[model samples]
Structures are given as structure tokens and as C-alpha cells.
Target chain A: MTKVKVAINGYGTIGKRVADAVALQDDMEIIGIAKTRPNFETVMAKDKGFNVYTLADRVGAMEKEGIEVSGTVEEMIKAADVVVDCTPGKVGATNKDLYEKAGIKAIWQGGEAHTLTGCSFNAETNYDEALGKDFVRVVSCNTTGLCRVLSPLDKEFGVKKARVTLLRRAADPGDIKTGPINAIVPNPIKLPSHHGPDVKTVIPNIDIATTAVKLPTTLMHLHTINLELEKECTAEDVESVLAEQSRVRFVGQGITSTAEIMELAKDLGRSRGDMWENCIWNESITMYEGELYFFQAIHQESDVIPENIDAIRAMMELESDASRSIEITNKTMGI
Target chain B: MTKVKVAINGYGTIGKRVADAVALQDDMEIIGIAKTRPNFETVMAKDKGFNVYTLADRVGAMEKEGIEVSGTVEEMIKAADVVVDCTPGKVGATNKDLYEKAGIKAIWQGGEAHTLTGCSFNAETNYDEALGKDFVRVVSCNTTGLCRVLSPLDKEFGVKKARVTLLRRAADPGDIKTGPINAIVPNPIKLPSHHGPDVKTVIPNIDIATTAVKLPTTLMHLHTINLELEKECTAEDVESVLAEQSRVRFVGQGITSTAEIMELAKDLGRSRGDMWENCIWNESITMYEGELYFFQAIHQESDVIPENIDAIRAMMELESDASRSIEITNKTMGI
Candidate 1:
């Protein structure tokens, strides 16, 4: 099989991780990476041996500042079979026309609106929906985490309603700017925070309500979830189903807090201490009068990385089976 | 009329603020403040002209370290008519016996469980319940904020069910050690956080469920509340009722965030930038299909300060009327 040439159009947290994951895939190759400026991340991308490209306008300026570049982003897009647009939240919408002009299939991150691609991709739930699609968006990290756990549960027990309260990280580890610094904010100050509606974009059948509170931690997003399953189930039964999934890991052996989870990742020698799996506390799993209650932590920076790779396979028709794609991606990424 | 002598058992965040509020009330006077350690706050309390007292065992050690003590906590309790126990959370329960042994009426902060006092005081909702009681526990800052708003609303519109999500500050501003540093935490990681039950202790008739998330904030707690009222009401109708309450302050005039609200307090020259009222966002007050939605910020350090003073009055029989006590507390504290 000819390798799918995947161009990563951003070298930040999610972008760089996706680039590495795609590089590990037997059926995919990193064509080039696009950087907006000559920052340390831009240099790091080049040092990692990925062919680096810059904005059409920044190509001259970036090279003038002693940064090497393969070509303009537009040139890279024309050469690649698909472009994974990770250029911040709203920037993906602006780059849609450029990909269209280049006549290339593109994958946008969860930051972009689902309407931008008209289809949201979650490898475990809706990979087939993205198959052969010209444009696809991988849902946001929180939504990705939610879909991973909720999809299988809904399929097994049928969800009556799922209510989640998220203790969201204020910023990614390397990010210094974003903060409440010392305040808990009802972000948007509205009921049913956007995560609930965002989940609907993927697992459209599930009844979910999410309320998110931004916190000071950069490591992970912790979710306290209460699910009223349509079918009665034991905590052990629910645990068995969750444990069966490749992307979910149960936290035990004295690892109780998010801090400990991150420490475990660091001890495991994972890059950037990334725990791509949903880190749910083993003891927190409880079945009280037919309702399931548990706490799970999502490594926001990397949980969606594998999904992005699976998204690439689905869009390119390289992998028709989602589990097969997920298996391959997981094996290569060592998730 | 003889002034009620109040003794503060802890000279920390809530304790110091309560002492100052008590000092401001015409019907109350601070007999002394109890500090476990001769910290900077201990010195500050002494410098502020509060008679600083320590544990009977620590009095010798504190005095050896050049700290002046008027008496032991037991002696202070004996002299005062009502002892406000503000020593950290579980410590109040331990000190319950001391107050009983001294044959003095006592008020415990929300840190203590309701069972310890058998009566939770909110001043607005259940001040009468605490009248002349031997032991009365003030509800938590979040609970106090909830009761102040919910009590008035439940009376005016009749609430069917109320749901609240609290973004709780991890620590007080003066606190240096407590932190996720950069994380949001599901405080109890359980369904219906303790605040709902805490509120129930004050207003048992109101059906309420609360979920709390701990954030890296030290300034204040932000609550996103959704209440289903029994009676149909417009946004204007709800706003007028809330506005009538003296303890609920509407945030308007471009005050969009908690930081600005704190800054507003500082600009107003409030002591330590304390906002004793629930700072509800004026624009967030909305009535949608019989459901009321709004955002309110609780100054965790000071919101309960006024309630402490009112509790003293109720327990001493200095004030028979709840509104009268609340009005007096509010006028003196500049709420």
C-alpha cells in the first residue's frame, strides 16, 4: 500500500503529537509541518527531522531569521494527500478555502466548529462517517474523552441520561498565558457548558449534560460523571466493559490523584508524560441504585492524538475498520 | 443595652474577617481572638487591638516567643457570652465540648458539620431557628450565598428544584500552601456535593442539588445556578425580588469577571477587598421557560462574616427579628 502523505499544519501541543503518531503508522508518512513563526516549537519540529513549512507570507521572513523551511504551506498542501489543520481554534475555518483550492482532503482538530467539516470523527464511534470524506473534524479533547467512554456504555446498557461535571485544566503544561490564575470561573457562566452540545455532534443519540469549571492545573481534566443507565448494571460489570476498551485505563496501586497519574506517566517514560487513555479511578466506580458514578481524568494535550491518526485512515480509505485503525494507531503510538 | 461579648477561636481567613465584622456591630464586641500559633496574623490581630489568646498549653510557648496573650481560649470562652468557633474544619467539633463546659452559647462556622450544632444558621432563612440555641452552626460560604438568594426566591416564586454548580476557590488569598497549582478538582468526586445538604440544613423545604469543583483560585467562588421555580416569572420579576435582598449585590457596569469584582471591592475601599454580598451578574439573571439562571460569586472569606454576627445576635436574644439582625449586620459590615 502506498503511504498516505499527511501534512501537519501546526507544530504546537496537539499538532506535534499528531505528527509523531502519524510518523509511527506503517501506512502514513509526515509530508511536512507548517509553523506560523520561528519560535522554539518551529525549531523543535525541524530538529525532530520533520520537513518544516511556513505561511506563504512568513516563508521569506522565517528563512531570513535563520530558520530552515521546505516551502510555503500552500506548496506543502498541494503535495500532500491530506492536511491535518491544527492551527489554533478558528484558524481552521480560514484555511478551509486553501485546502479546497489545493483539492486535498483535510482533517481539522476539535477546536474547529463541526459545521466547518459537516462531520465530526471519533474513531471508536463514527470513523465510517469520515470515510472518503473531503473534510473531517476530530472532536475536542473533552468531547473525545466523553465519546470514548459514553459510546461503549450506550451501546452496552443504553444511557438514560449522563451528567458530567468537569474540573478543566486552565492551560496545557507548556502554556503560560491562559489562566484564572487564582479564581474558579463558571466559564461562559451558562448551564450545559459547550462540552455537552459538542458531544452531541459526535454521539448524537446520547443524552448528555456537561458543566465545566476551569481550574489551575495543566496536567489533566477530571470528570465526575453520573450516568443513569437504561439497564441495571453492577459496578463490576461497568468496570469490565470500560476495562475492555483499548483507550481506557483504570487507576489503582495508590495512584489516586491527577498528580499521581501524571507522575505515573512520567515514570513510564511516555513522551511529555502523556496518558492518552482515560484515567478512571478504580475505586471511584460505584453503582448506586442503578446509576453509575465514577471519576476519570483526561490528559487534554494528547488524549485525541490517536483519534486524529485514525481520522486520517478513515478519510483516506486506508483502513475501513475503526477497531483495526485504533489497534494499529495504539500499537504504533504505544498508548 | 449590654453589648454581646464575642470570642473568635481562630485568627485565620474567616476568623479575622468575622472578628472585624463583630467589632463593627454596635450590639457586639470582641472579647478576644484565639490563635493556635504566633504567626504574622497573630501579631496583626494583636496590633489591631484584639486581645489575642492561645491554647492553655501554647500560651507559655507563644509568650516565650515574645507573643502577648490576654488569656487562654478557655478563659476567653468563659468571659464571652457567645464563642464563635472558627478553628479549621474538624477542630470546631473538638472545641464543642469546651464551649459546653464553659456553659456558654456557641456559634460554629460552616466548617463544622450541622450535626455538631443541630441547627445551621443562615441569618436570612433560619436565624429564628438558632434563637437562644446553645449551639448554632453557620452554613458554609457557598451555602450562605445559596441561602441568601434561594431563600428570597423560594419565598417569592416558590422553587420546585434548584441545581447549582460551584467553582470553589482552593484557598483563601493569604493562604500560600493549598493548591492544585493548575488544576480543577471534583472536590468530593460524588453525586450531589455536600453543599446541597448543607443548604438543606438551613432551608430544608427547598429541593436543591449542588456539585462543587475546586479550582486554583484564592479570591472567591463562582456559582452557576439553575432553579426551576413553581410559579411563572419574568427575568424582570426575578431581578426585582433578588435586588430587594440587602446581601445580594448585582454585578453590572461592565464588571464581567471575578478579578474585576475583587478590584471593585478594592476600589470601594472594602477591608482586604472583601465583598460580603453575593456578587450576582446582572446580565446573567435570566428567566427561561420557568427556569431561572444566573451567575453569582461568593467571597469565601467574607460572605459568611455578616452571618456570624447575625448568629451571635440570634443566640444571645439581642435580636428577635431575622431581618433586623440582617439589616444591622449589613449596615455595619457595609455589605
Candidate 2:
């Protein structure tokens, strides 16, 4: 099988993880990784044997700063079959025109607005919608977490509505600048807080509302979800459905918090201690009458990595089936 | 004002906090605090000038261990106006016979089945229901949290149904034994998990379901609540109602997690960093169509402390009105 050449733009938190995940896939290869600055991550990317590329404008500056670069981002984009844009939110929107001019399939991160890609992608929720698309935006970590659980539940029993409270990590572990030093801050200070609308970009028909609160921790984002189902079901019934999904891992007894889940990822020797699966507490699956409730933890740094890889297969039509693509991604990334 | 004599029958997590809260009330006095062991808590109770009483069976054993005691649990029960049973779960059930025999009004913690007192109490939710009741059970921390928000929402807008996901702290900060060391464990591994039925013991007419999972942290429990309201409301509308309740503290921007809430309590010079109010993230208050959603932190150690104090007021008819009792308790404890 001919390997799909993939280029990653913006080698930051989500970008670097995607680069590593794409490296493990048998059908895809990381052709190059692009960044604007010659920072520590540029050095780390080079050490990982990834061909480092700089933005067209910053190529000279990067080389001047003693950073080795193989080529410019434009060169990488032109060479690859697909360009995954992991740039900062608004920057991804700016790069859309560049990928289009190169006639390359593009995958954008959730940080960008949905209009940038025209569709939000989740392997479990909207794999079919993304198949053969020229551009796809992998949903945010929280959205991916929600879709991973909601898609199955919505399919099995049918969702009347879903309400999710996102206990978000204030900043990424590596991010020391931004805070919530001594408080829980609401980002938008409004209802639905963009997450619910983001979910709709993939599962357009589902009735869902999300409220988010940023917390002090940097480990993981915990989601407490309540889904009102169309039909009455038992907790066992819901648990079994979620367990069948490849991307959903049922965390049973003894593992209590996001800290433990991250520790387990490290103990298992996962790359950067990234837990790609949605860590759903198995015992937390509860159903009363027709209402179902559970708590799941999202590894903010890595959950989207798997989805990005799946989006590559999805956009390329290398795997049109979600389960097959998810299986392959999980097996390769050890999700 | 004639002071109401209150005896606490457990010097553990909930018991210890309630003892200090009772000590703060001008209308109430901590007559005694009972313990079965001569542990650190017993010594701490004595240092706080609370008369330390020993369980009837362990009085001799406690004395032999060089622990000074004021009297036996039996004598404390006879002299007190109300005996608050904060013992271990089943132990409260056993102590019920003693309180009944002594003809003293009794208050039980949520750990004991609601049947022990046949009336679960929350100052904000069922303060009127508990007035003049011989036996009152102060609902669990999580239940008190749900009621603090739900009671007002239900009354103001009429909740059609409420579904709550409780991200529970695995154990108390002082508790070193109970886990989840490395996993998120569901306490009951079943639907509703006793919390829903416990809420019914206080608010019988409201349709609510609760699912609980234990996390590794000892900070506080986070509750993600979804309420299907009877009529459409705005986020501001919901926020205004929650802010009106004395036990519900609206956590606005700059506060991100329970850790910060606890720190704020300490900075405010609260005893043991006790935040008696349910710290609801004001930014998290959201209403879409007719459904309302929000995230709130329940201080598992001290949330029920105020509820216990109000239960004392209700059981004694010293303050039959919940608002009056809650106001007094909040002002006294600086909630």
C-alpha cells in the first residue's frame, strides 16, 4: 500500500502529539513538521527524527537562530497528500487558503472555527461525513470526549437531550502563563459556552447543551455528563454499549481520579503519558427511569491525537468505516 | 436567648466540622462530642474545650488509654436537647434506639439510611418539613449541594426533572484508608446510587436522579447538574435565583476549582477552611431553550455542617423558618 504523506503545521501541544501519532500509523507518514519559532519544541521535534520545516516568513530567522530546517511550510504542504493545520485558533483559518492552493486535503484542529473546514470530524460520531472531504476539523478535546460517549448512547437508546458540565483544566501542563490561580472562572460567562455548538458541527441533529468552568488543575479535564434518553434503560445496558467502542475505555474500580489515569498511562509507557481513550468510570454509568448519567475524564493533551489520525484516514478515504479506522488508530497509538 | 444543648455522637469528618459550627452559634451550645477511640480527634476536641464523651461500650477502654472523658454517651444524650449522630454508617442506625430511649430529638448524617430518621434535612430545601420533627437526618454533602441549587430552581421555575453527575472525592482529607487509589469507582455500581432517593426524603415532589463516582482527590465533590425546567429562562435568571439562597455561593470569574475555593476560605480566615455554601460557578450557569445547566463544588467536609446546624434549629423549633435559620447559621459561621 502506498503510504499517505502527511505534514503537520504548528508544532505545539496538539500539533506535536499529532505528529507522533501519525508516525505510528502504517498507512501514513509524517513528511514534515512546521513551526514559526525556533523554540525548544523545534529541537524536540528534530530529536524525534521528524523533518523540521519553518513557516515561509520565519525560515530565515529559524536557521539564523541555529535551528536546522529541511524546508519551508509551503514546500511541506506542496509535497504532502494532506496537510494537518495545528496552528493557533485564528492562524489555522489563515492557513486554509495555502492548503487549498496546494490542492491538498487538510485537517484542522478544534481551536479553529468550524467554518474554516466546513465540517467538524469525530471518528466515532462523524467519520462517514468526513470521508473524501477535502478538509476536516478534528473537534476539541472536550467535544471529542463528549462525542465518544454520546455517539454510542445516542445510537443505542436515542438521546432526547444531553447536558454536560466541563470542569476544564485552566491551562496545559506546559503552559505556566495563563491561570486560574485561586478561582474557577467561566470562560464565556454565557450558556452553552461554544462546546455544545461545536458538537453540533458533527452530530447536527442531537439536542445538547454544555456549560464549562475552568479549574486550577493542569492534568486532565473532567466531564460530568447527564443524558436524558428517549427510552428507559439500565446502567448495565449503557455500560455495555460504551465498552464496545474502541476509543472508549471503561475505567473500573480502584482508579479514582484524572491523576491516577495519567499515572496509568505513564506506567503503561504511553508516549508522553497520553491516554487517547476517553476514560469513563465504569461504575459511574447510572440510569434512573430514562435519564442516564456518568463522569468521564479527557486527557486534554492527547485525546485529539487519535481523532486527527482518524481524520487523515477519513479525508483520504483510506478507511471509510469508523470502527475499522478507530481500531487501527487505537492499535497503532496504543489508545 | 436560651441556648439549645447539642451533643455530637461522632468526632470524625462530618462530626468534627458540625461540632465547630455548633460552637459558633449563639443560640446553640456543643454539650459534648462522643468518640469510640482515644485518637487524635478526641484530643483535638478536648483542646477546643468541647467536653469529650466516650461511647458507652468504650468508656473504660478510652479511660485506660489515658483519654479524659466528661461522661458516657448515654448521659450526654439524656442531658442534650438534640443528639446529632455522625457516627459511621450503620452505627447511626444502632444509636437511634439509644436516642429514642432517652426521649431526645436526634439528627443523623446522610451516611445512615434516611429511614433512620425518616426525614432527610437541607436548610434551603426542606427546612419547613423538618420543623418540630423529633428525628432529622441532615442529607449528605452531595445531597445538600443538589438541594441548595435545586430547591431554589424548582421553586422559582419548577424543575420538570433533574439529572446530576456527582464527581465525589474518594475519601475525606483526614482519611488515609479508603480509596480509589488509581481509579474512578462507582460507590454502588448501580443507577441513582441512593442519592436520588435520599433527595426524595427531603424534596419528595421533585423528580431527580443522581449518579456518583469517587475520584482520587480529597478536596471536594464537583456536581454537574442538568435541570429540565418547565419554562424557558436565561442564564442570568438562573444565576439570580441561586445567588438568592444563603447556602448557595455563586463563584464568579477568577475562581477555577475547589482548591481555589478552599484557599479563599482560608484567606477569609474560616475555621478549617470550611466553605459552608455550595460554591456554584456563576459563569457555568446556562440555559438553552428550557434546560438549565451549571457546575458547582460541594465542600464534602463542611457543606453539611450548616445543614446539621439548621437541622438542630428545625428539630428544636428554635428557628422554624429555613431562611432565618440559614441566615443565622451563615452569619455565625461566616459562610
Candidate 3:
């Protein structure tokens, strides 16, 4: 099997994780990583025997760390089959032209979505739509979790409108200038938070509305949702349907909490290992009389990693079949 | 005219604020305040020439905080024609026995509602129902704001089922611990917070459901509400109607903010100046194509402060007509 050659354009936290993931996946190979300047991730990737490139400086930071580089960003994309643009906001839009020039298929991370030409996707929600697509925006971790849970629920039970309250952890501790570490910056889970509603605009059947508040925590997004179901159903019925998904679990408790789910992650070896995966601990989707309430913990780094990986492979046409994409995603998640 | 004697049992932040308000009202008199230990509020009230009573000795610093003082929680009920219970959780219930035994008309705050023998009461929403009634639990601030807004909207445009996500500012920064300041206490507003189905237990023709989260802020509670209206209506109509409210200012501009309203309040010479007593910044009640998306900031301290004052005067039989209650409320608010 030909190796999937890839170049990570942004070497930030998520990008670094992506580079490592590509290197570890059997069907993938890292071509090189492009950095505005040298960062620890680039150094680490270089140490792992991958090419590291600094387009801004012909003289790379590998010298400071006593390592060698191989190519420019142009060379990196020219050599790779897929380009992952994980650069920050508008920076990705500017770098996207570089990938397009090389004719390399691109997988734009959450930040680059608005600038991309193709669909915003969660593999579970819209994988088939992603097939044969040249560029795809991986949904943000919170939306990915929501789409994963809500898509099936929307299909099983007709959804009218959903009111979502996301208790979001800080993207990082220093995200604020001087606000309380305790202040909750209420916004949607996704960028331009209301864009999640716009994504629903593309679909004819679903109407999902979300509101999020950032609490002082990292590692997970907890959502308290009220679903306007088309018909009446019990919490058990909702739980049973979600529990069937290999990637999804039913915590079987009322009102899934972040602490409860976090502890579950600790119990599940996430604290020791498997920290990258979604540690959905308290996953009960309790339906009260007619509304549904549940809490979920999604690892911002890894729960969506498999989907990002899957999008790359599908864009490259290495996994062209719809069933193949689903199979690979489920297999990667070990569902 | 005889002074309508009133005594506050819990001389904390709210208790003191209430006492200050009572001292300002001409017909009402603060007979005395009963407390477990002499706190700063008690000392300040005394310094201001109001009578104060210490039910027990100061536990001292550590003992001074969170420690209960020994004495009769029931004595306040005997000391006044109308007693206000400002104690925490179960203690409020414990004091309820005193009010009932003394056969004095009593006013209970929302926290004491769990032990309330009856229903949630909002001065605007169910003030008429409270006439000639004793043992009223003033809905929590968040609930009070929500119920007040919903009452007008529901009466004008019948609602199917309403949902609200309360982003409440902490009473102040220090409100998190045993708080005079309640910061970032998620869902601190409580469940079915104010808007529950069949509110007829307290008032008739009301069926609404709500939930809340407390953010680190003071001065306002911002409610992001989604209501399913029985009849289709334009956002302008709803905006015009809500704008018509003397107490509700439709403060929603392009990007609605609670800070704007707080500034308005300050400009208006409110204690700190919060606009409209409570500011509802939602531009519309109806959605882009479906549902309602709007935000309202309810002044926890003031919006209900005037209402609480009115309820006190009316409960004490100082006013025969409730319209006079509105006048007294407006007069105290200086509107």
C-alpha cells in the first residue's frame, strides 16, 4: 500500500498532535511540517525522523536544537499527497493558496473553515457528503461531539429545534487578558459560534441552536441540551439508541456532569494514557416528559482526531468508498 | 399614621439592603433586626441609627464566617408585623415554623422555596395572586426576570413551550464562597428556575420551563431565551411590545451586551445605574426563520428590589390598591 504523505502547515498544539497521529497511522507518512518559526513540536517531529521546514527563515531553529531540515513549504506540499492547514484563522486562508498551487488535496482544520470552499463536516454526521471532496473543514471538537450525538437522535426522532448550553473549558488558561479564571465566556462551541446553526441551514430537516459559556477548565466541553423532539419518548429510549454506537456510550445516569465524566476519563486510563481520545463518562441522554438532557465530555485534542484523519484519507481518495470511510472511522475509534 | 413595623431576621447583604430600603420608605419602619452574631451589616445598620440585635456572641473571624449563632430564629417573627427570612437553605425552612407559629405574615426569598409550602411568586407575574396571601416565595432573581418578561410576552403571544439559558452575573466577584457574591456557580440559578409548567400552583394560565448558569459578574442576569410561540409573529412586533414596557428597555443593539445596560443603569443614577431596572437586549423574539433569539439582563438587586418593596407594603396592608403598589415601586426606583 502506498503511504499517505502529509505536511502539517501549523505546528501548534493540535497540529503537533496531528503530525504525530499521521506518523503513527499505518496508511500515513509525514512529509514535513511547516512552521512560521521553530516550535517544540517541530523539534520533536524532527527528532522522530520527520522533515521540519521553516519557510520564514532559511536558517531553521533545528540549529538551536542541533537538528537538520529538509524543505520549504512549497517543497513540502509539492511532495505530499495531502496538506493539513492548521494555521491560525486568516493565516490558513493565506497559506491555502500555497497548497492549491501544488494541487495537493487539503484538509482544513476548524480554524480555516470559513476560508475553505468545501463542506464543514463531522464524519458521523455527513461522511458521504465528504467523499470525493477536495477540501473539507473538520468540525470543532464541541460541534463534532454534538453532531455525533444529535445526528443519530435527529434521524431517529424528528428534531424541531435544539437549545444547547455548552459549559466550555478555556481553550487555554491564558485566553483572557485580566478576566476571572472563573469567568465563563458564553459563545457557541464552534467558531462564529452561530455557524453551527448555519451548518444546519445546509440540511433540510434539522434545526439546532447552541449557546456556550466558557468555564475555567481545559480538556473537555460539557453540553446541557434540550431537544424539541417530534414525538414523545423516554430517556431510556434515547439512551438505548445512543449506546448502540461503538464511539458513543450511555453513562445511564441522570444529568451527566463534567466532574463525573472527567473522573470516568481518569478511571478509563485517560489520565495515565489515552488522553487524546474523547472521554465521554457521564453520557446519559435523559428525556424529561418530552425534552432531552445529557452531559458529554469531549477531548478537544483527540475525540475529533480520527475524523480529521479520516477526512484527509477520503480527500486523497485513498479511502474512496463511503463504507470504507465509515469502517475506518469506527475502526480508528475502536468502536 | 402608625408605622408598619418590620424586622429582618437575617442581617446579611440582602437583609441590610432590604433594611436600607425600608428605612427610606415613609410608611414602613424597621423596628429592629435580629441576627446570630453582630456582622458588618448589623454594625452599619446600627451606625446608621437603626436598631440592631445580636442573637449570640461573635464566634470570631473563622467563627464569624459560616458559623451559625445560637438563639431563637423564631424571635424575629414575634418582633414584627411582617418578618423576612433571609437565612440559608434549610435554616429558612427552620425559620418558617417560627413565622407560622407566631401567626405573622411572612415574606420568603427564592432560596427558601424548596421548603415553601406553596408556589413560586414573582411580584409582576403573580402579585395579584399574592394579595391576601401569606408565605410567598419571591422567585429567585433569574426566575423573577424570566417570569416577568414571559408574562407579558405570553399574554400578548401565546407560547407553546419556552426555554431559557440564564447567564447570570455573580451578585459580585466575592459571591462564590458562602456568598454575598455568587460567581461562576454553574446552574446556580437552579432548575425549572422560575418558569415551570403549571405555575398555577402560584398563578394561573402560565406554563413555562427554564434553566440557568451563573457567570462571574454582578449587576445583571442575561437570559438567552428561545420561545416557541403559538402564533407566527415578526421580530419587530415583539421588539415594539417589549420596548413598550416601562420597566423593560429593549437594549439589544447589533451585538447585545449586558455591560451596555449596566452603563445605562449608572447613567440613570441607579444605585450603580442599571438601565430599565432590567435590560432585555434581544432584538427579536422570533428567529431568523424559526424560533426566538434574544437576550435580557435582569438586575437581580434592583428589578426585584422595587417589586420586593411593593410586596412588603401590600402584604402589610399599607396599600389597599395594587396600582398604588406599582407607584410605590416606581417611586422607590425613582423612575
Candidate 4:
């Protein structure tokens, strides 16, 4: 298979992780990294011998100070076949059109989905729908981690109702923007939360009620899940299946400790927001003969890494070729 | 009408409130105050012109050392025509039979109800059931506030489902025990939070799920409630009815500010737990034309104060004989 060319737009936490993962992939090559912000990560990316691109304002400053930078979004788009837009939510709505116009397939981050049209990809649950689509927006870390467990079970297990309480991070990965909720105590003003409705855009017909509390934590978002299942299965039986998933680790005894989840993420050098990479505990997932219970921890920053790799796979028109996709995932993950 | 005599079985924070409330009633008279541990409160009651009795291990301490105490359960039981068991849970289970055998009609606290009970009284919805009954356990502070507001509406308006997240206080008037929740962690478990099923023993048909978090403050408990009604009503209608109830306070534009709820609670002292005293904001109580809507916040501690007063009325046989009951409530509250 031809080597895949990948470019990460927005070299924030998630974007850079995607850049690093693509470089390790045997079948993929990191063509460019575009960042609008000045940060340690951006500086670190440049020192690593990768082609780092800066915005026009930075490029102009570099021009005066004799520092080189990529000046336009178009230049970054032209650098690779697949562009991953990791900009904040509203940015993706407009950038989705630009990427498609440049004939470069793009994967929009959770924040950008409000403007995208193609599909929302949660690898385990909706990878097939996302394949061959030009613009794929990966759902939020919490949603992706949960749907990985639920959509599959809801299809096999029959759900009566579901309730989720998301314990979120106080700040986004790095400084993005200070919204209204920053200083204020962000309480759930509406039921099911906006996260549930966002989940519905893809996994329709799921009766979900989500509530969230933004805590002072920085990396992982914890979701306490409760769902009534139609068929009864022993907790042991369900645990075994979840443990086998490639990206998911069935965390132990239901409430997986924060330390354990972080150890797994660190071992993988997972930046943040990597689907299925979020640690989920099997015991926290109580499957008591048709009654399913569990708590899932999703690394909000690194979960979308694998999806970004997949975007490059689609861009190269090798989506149906699992052999090529697997090569890319393994290479990107340095496995 | 013959006024009923009430003996306070335990002279602690709650017990004192009960005793003071009873003293204010014209039809009700406090036979005396009983204490197993003759602490400062017992002495304070005695100094304040109360007839105090003790069930301490050794009454010699009060006689010789000048520290008053109750010597035995037997003496406390014999002293009152009716005994109110405010002892802690699990511990109270052991003594239920003793209170029953003594023919000392009893009124129990919420925690004690899991072990004993004739009825869980909220006065407005279930007061009649407690009348003429031998044992009446007042619902939990959270349950008392929630049921009073929802039950009345559920009866008047068609009901569907309900969800409540309680940010409870670290202490109640007499909660000597440390808190179960150290911080705002989702009730360590991942299911529909078992607290709801416990609430169900009283309102069986209602689908109630509760998530409780304990904060450091002792002022009041706050609840964000979402319910699906069989019929539709505007936020204004809910506000009017809540304001009409003595314990429910319409604090306006959603009970968003925790500080504001405290202010309302302070101003409404004595009457603080009046049926409608706890503030529920008009804005926070969002109503949709559809079946589902949201309403938030009822100061848990003070909201139930009025009900406690009312429970005293019925416990003292002052409900049917209204004149004496009104006088009691007035004097206890200093109104």
C-alpha cells in the first residue's frame, strides 16, 4: 500500500497527538502540523524535525524576525491528503468547507461538529458509517467512550432507559477560550445535557439522560452510567467481552481508580481524546442479569487520536482495505 | 378540646426544636425533655424553665458532679405519653420494640423509618395518615421538601417521571455524625443511585432517581428537579403554587445563586421551613409546552421546619383541635 500523507490542523493537545501518532504509523507519514497558538508543545513539535506550520500573523512576525512559518490555511491543506481540524467548535463549521474544497478529507473534532455534515465517528460503534465520508466529526470524549460501551450493548442487550452524570475537567486541553462557564458554577441547566443530543445525531433512538458537573480535574472526564437492560447477563460474562476490545480496558471492580486510568493513558503516550483508549471498569459496569451498571473514564484530550489516523486512511482511498487501515493504526500507535 | 401532652425523647438540636415548637402550641404541652447524654443542651433546657429528665448511665454524676444526664431508657419511656425517637439509624432499630411495648406512642425521624414506622408524614400530603397512628416517621429533609412540592402537583397535575440531584449539607440541626460524602463526587456508585429506591417506599409509583453530593456548608440542601408531567403547566403556575405553600419560596429566575437561597432562608427564619419557604426560582423552573420540564432548589433544612411544626401539631392531637395548635406554632416560631 502507498504510504499515507497526514496533516494536523490546530496543533493543540489533540491535534499534536494526532501528528505524533501519524508519524509512528508504518503505512502513514506526517506531512505537516499547523498551529495557531504559541505553546511548549508547538515548540517541541518544531525541534522534533517535523514540518511545523504557523498562522499568517506568526509568519509575518517570523518574516520580520527571520523565522519561517506556514502563512495560510490553504498552504496547510495543500501539505497533505487528509487534514484533521482540531480547532474549537465554531471553527470547524467554516473549515469543513475549506478542507473539502481543497480535496483533502478532514476529521473534525467534537467542538467542530455543529458545522459539519458528513458523519460522527465513534470507532467501535460507527466506524463503518464514517468510512468513505469526506468530513467526519469525532464525538466528544465522554460520548465516544460511552457509545463504545452502549451502542453495541443496546443493539445486543435492549435498553429501557439510561442516565449519565459526567464529571468533566475544569479547563480544556491548554488554553482555548474562557467561555461563560469558566468562573461560574456550571450546572446542568437542561436534561440529558447537550452531550446526549449530540450523541443522538449519530446513535439515534437511544433514550439517554445526561447531567454534568465541571470539576477541577484536568485530564479525564468520568461518567457514571446506569441503564436497564432487557436480557440478564452475569457481570462476569459482560466483563469478558469488554476486556477483549483492542482499545478498551475493562477497568476492575466497577470503579476504576483515577491512578489506574492515567497509568494506561501514559503507557500509550496518549495525548487526549483517543476513542476506546479511555479506561472503563468492568465492575463499575454492573451487568446483573439484564441490569447493566458501570463507570467510564474518558481521557478528554487524547481519545480522538485513532480517529485522526483513520481519517488519513480514508483520504488515501484505502478505507475498505482493512489491511492498510490496520497497518496505519499500528504505525500511528507505534505498535 | 383537650390538648395533648408531648414528651421530647431526646434533647438534642432537633429535639429542642420539637420541644420549643410544642411549648408554643396552646393545645400541646411538653411533659418534659429526656436525654440519655445530659450534655449542655439538657442543662440549657433546664435553665430555660424546662422540666428535664435523664436516662444517663449514672444519675449520680448530675447530683454529685453537677452534670445532668438521663440514666436509662426505661425512665425516659415512662416519662412521656408520646416519645419521639430521634436516635440514629441502625441504632434505633434495636429500641423500636421497647418504645412500642411501653405504650409510649412514638414519632420517629427519617433515618429511623428504615427500621420502624406507622407513616412517613409530610403534613401537606400525608398528615392525615399520621393522625391517630401510633408511630409516625417524618420523611428525610430531602424527601420532605421534594415530596411536599411534587406530590401536591402530581395529585393536581398528571405525573410521569422525576429526577433530583441533591447537594446536601455536611450537617443537619443535630447531625453529630460525619458526612457520607466528603465532596461533590457522584454517589460513589454508578447505578440509578440507590437513594431513589429508598425514597420509593413512600411514593411507590413514582420513578425517582436521586444523586446526592455533600458539601461543606450546613445552611441548607439544594435540589435541581426535572419531571415529566402528564399535563403541561407554565413555570409561572408552578411558582404560584409553590409560593402559596408555606415551605416553598419562589426566589425568582431559577434558584441559580446558592447565596440567594441562604438569604431567603435567613429572612424566613422560624417560618423558614414553612411549606413554601425554601426558594424555587421562576427562571430555574423552566417549563416546556411538552410533558418534560425542570425546576430547581428547595432549601432542605429550613423548608421542612414548618412541616416539623405541623407534625408536632398532629402528634400532640392538636390538628383536629385547631385553636391550640395555632397558638403553639405562633409561640414556638416567635411570630
Question: lDDT, candidate 2, residue A79?
Answer: 91
Flag clash pairs in model 3: A187-A212, B170-B217, B175-B181, B175-B182, B265-B273, B265-B274, B265-B275, B266-B273, B287-B291
TM-score of 1: 0.92
lDDT against the true structure, per candidate, is 0.86, 0.83, 0.63, 0.63
Best by TM-score: 1
RMSD of 1: 2.7
Give the worst 10-residue stretch by lDDT in candidate 2 chain B. Answer: B181-190
Best by the lDDT measure = 1
Candidate 1 displacement at residue A293 in angstroms: 4.0
The residue-by-residue lDDT of candidate 3 on B277-309, one tens digit each, is 556544334465456666566766556556667
Q: Which candidate number would show the highest DockQ if scored against the true structure?
A: 1
B87-113: candidate 4 lDDT, tens digit per residue: 655555576788878887777776665
| lDDT tens digits by residue: candidate 1, A19-98 | 98888889999999999889888888878899999887898878887888899998999999999999999988999999
- All candidates: DockQ: 0.40, 0.27, 0.19, 0.15
| Better candidate by TM-score, 1 or 4 | 1
Per-residue C-alpha lDDT of model 2 across residues A235-316, encoded as one tens digit per residue: 8888889889887887765676787788888998998988888998877776656667777889989999988998999889
True-vs-predicted CA distance for residue B91, candidate 2, Å:
3.3
The CAPRI category of model 4 is incorrect
